[model samples]
Target: MAWMSWTLPTAMFFITIAVILISMTAWQIISPCIERRGFLPLATTRGDRLFIGLLSSAFIHLAFVALTDVNIAVATALCAIWMIVLMRWG
Candidate 1:
């Protein structure tokens, strides 16, 4: 019954959007390097990389927010592992 907190969900929604925007902007700025490396870049007119990045960032932040509320150390480790998996498999 206690889990029905409106405030937490609202905060998470806003925070996720902010994180996605900031991350996407940063990705766009560094897209040239990403392109040179043969990865699809955010600056591409095709928009594939931008879309993927936004989606992945949303999940990443959501996971971080959920796990961090329980344990900071575990959340940090999870984030690192998530990043590695995304870079290797995505």
Candidate 2:
């Protein structure tokens, strides 16, 4: 859309989010998950953990952008790692 700025990084971010959602849907359909407790304070299903991870990662990205002059790639990498850990054992 002309009203929106579709830069490469922005486009990639959205595309990645779409892909993850689609994949997660397929995964749930193939093998359903159950709620379980991890390092997090509450028991949660895979989808719940995913939602939390993504939401928190957004905050992490915003914090990086707002607070530091560091490169965005660093934040992205950190988010990726954090999400993986969260998914595995949140």
Candidate 3:
């Protein structure tokens, strides 16, 4: 008998959800700073900042994975750092 392993798509589906969850959690933690910076909440005007944050988060995670082969935990941390930097700098 042989054991069946998880497929790549299955792993990717869970990873995608994890990334989104991490991004949303990071956004929530930064919501106050965002408001202080005069950016509207996610409910207002299509959330331009949120969109930009999400895009930057994805890129940061991908780049870290590509360069260092880090696990999801490190990738998430890097994404959070990128989000904070972008919010502060931009």
TM-score of each: 0.33, 0.92, 0.42
Candidate 2 backbone clash number: 0
Following a full C-alpha superposition, what root-mean-square deviation does model 2 have from the true structure?
Answer: 1.6
On TM-score, the leading prediction is: 2
lDDT of 3: 0.66
- RMSD to true structure for each model, in Å: 7.4, 1.6, 8.0
Which portions of model 1 show Cα errors greater than 4 Å?
1-6, 30-83
The reply for model 3, stretches above 4 Å from the true place, is 1-46, 85-89
Q: What lDDT score belongs to each candidate, Candidate 1 first?
A: 0.58, 0.96, 0.66
Candidate 2, position 54, lDDT: 94
- Clash totals for all candidate models: 0, 0, 0
The local lDDT score (0 to 100) that residue 84 gets in candidate 2 is 97
Best by lDDT: 2
Model 1: how far residue 74 lies from native, Å: 11
| lDDT of each residue in 1-90, candidate 3, tens digit only | 997678997789679768977876786677633333434343321145556778877887778778886687888877778667655544
Which model is ahead, 2 or 3, in terms of TM-score?
2
Which ten residues in a row are the worst by lDDT in model 3? 37-46
